[model samples]
Target: MEQSNTLLDVKKLEVSYGHVDALKGVDVTVNQGEIVVLIGANGAGKTTLLDTILGINTPRSGSIQYNGTDITGRSADINVREGLTIVPEGRGVFTSMTVTDNLLLGAHHNMHESSDKIERVYQWFPILKERSDQMAGTLSGGERQMLAIGRALMSAPRIILVDEPSIGLAPIIVNNIIEILVNLNKEGYTILLSEQNAYKALKIAHRGYVLETGQVVLSGTAEELLEDPAVKDAYLGA
Candidate 1:
């Protein structure tokens, strides 16, 4: 596939929680309509990086450029409105709300809402449409994951940041979710996925980054990282 143009650029991003550094000068980028995977173990600052980009957590230093505009230090709500959306870790769905309502919250920023986006989400995950009126808490783990991704899509973001998407899901459901994400990428949505499941994540990603203690230790095409002995021993369990 021809490489899409750059959509997001992060240069030497650094974040900290008052004395404990979480991200130390990390450089990452996501191109238009490409799926970029960040694979690392727990506490590697993957989530922190996404949070900083989304403005849920402010960065101590470094710059974030989205579509060539500076977005560092911008509020979370503003970022969402500006076409940057994040489907956070743990599938942060509103359990007490109906599935439809959760999706509406994602579209709150839109001045002219479209039922077509909702319909598209349903088409993507038929189960969500089946449980549209059901409380999110009543849905299965896979259903909740689907709802999370669907809700993010309601915003119609130019880039979607997903953190630990496969965490706490069965292998079959994980495969399903990964396939959906891959399809989304093929449809011209740029995706930045942070995952612990290195093997599965690399399968569909165009490129992969290995984060170690908040730093990018390795980065290459997915096939190259998958074949690396170091990555195989540490993340791939080979």
Candidate 2:
């Protein structure tokens, strides 16, 4: 209940791919212990923003600050080592590897404490433990997502950037994922959730930003966004 500090700050961010602009002067922030949702349609720059922050893509301009340090151009591995990690959109687990092996890959940087980190991840996704020796490619969509998230946790990250977690998932499974995110937030993990399910995203968010064509069109507390007329018609079907 003491969330008051900014953990991640993105200022005037601009990113482009060859000739196409992906993020244009987008400013955003994630406070400690807060679940800040970014609701946008496909190609709205949500993933680009997350990726740019995680160092997957280089930004054309702007600054990315994590815990008050300017890390605009930091490498992904160093960023992960410094407590920032992402659960990519496609649940990019090692399909050929076993569940336990995949999780162990996440602890590559912190292998000195690999066992303890793996145990912590198991507590969050026991199905991972149940399927420890099973190949990741054979797991269901929901289980794969759990492994992706659990794998990120193995790095002992302070901020988790979850990209489109509900993509290709059933309603009940989406609900389960949302609840797991809420629980993770309660356990003190700051999350920046990029989601297309606007209503569901806003429901559990502390604050939210609405992205449109690489720009932030709206932002406010969860309650305000949920009640906004534009939000209802465009996203909630209200």
Candidate 3:
């Protein structure tokens, strides 16, 4: 795909924390309206890559381009305003705040009224609306995940970075969340999902990349990855 037409492009990206190198010359792209999944074991640098893309962690080298603009050193707040939002790992909701309050904060950068956006989020996750006045900390794991994704939608983002949406949930709840993400992608929301559940991630993804020790060791269409003997053995336990 051409760089100009891509929604996000990471070229030779590297990142480190102090003396520990996390991402090593990683490259990936998310086209408009596509679901791209990153699959790996724990400590494969998936979270580090997403954090770097969102400017939560600065890149040690290389460039990050979003919608044809360089956003390498942009702040997280600015990146969110510019339509890149992340529903981070651990369902990073503001536990101390009301569900409604958390959603409102997601739209802080927008100067216009957020009533419409709030309504849209509620429509996407009606359970959130039901628990609108409840403290975010009190919600169950699945509800918290919904609230997190709903909060990101409040920003009206064009692209969403989701890390481990299936973490710590029952199998049924994980399936529901994956279905919601697929539906969101169908509705033209570009997504880059980082996951440790390779089987589940491949089921909903259009394409996938497998990372090992900070390098992309395997990549292909989801169907291809699902059937590959190596992927099946290492990730799917087939």
lDDT of each: 0.92, 0.94, 0.92
Return the TM-score for candidate 2, rounded to 2 decimals. Answer: 0.97
Residues 1-238, candidate 2, lDDT per residue (tens digit)? 3234889999999999999999999999999999999998899999999999999899999999999899998999999999999999989999999999989888778888898888888888888899999999999999999999999998889999999999999999999999999999999999999999999999999999999999999999999999999988898888
Q: What pairs collide in candidate 1?
A: none
Residue pairs with colliding backbones in model 2 are none
- Write one digit per residue (lDDT tens) for candidate 1, span 76-167: 99999999999989999999999999999889899365588899899999999899999999999889999999999999898999999999
Residue 61, candidate 3: alpha-carbon lDDT:
95
Candidate 1 structure lDDT: 0.92
Please list the Cα RMSD from the true structure of every candidate, rounded to 1 decimal place.
Answer: 1.7, 1.6, 1.0
Q: How accurate is candidate 2 locally (lDDT)?
A: 0.94
Which residue segments of model 1 deviate by more than 4 Å? 1-4
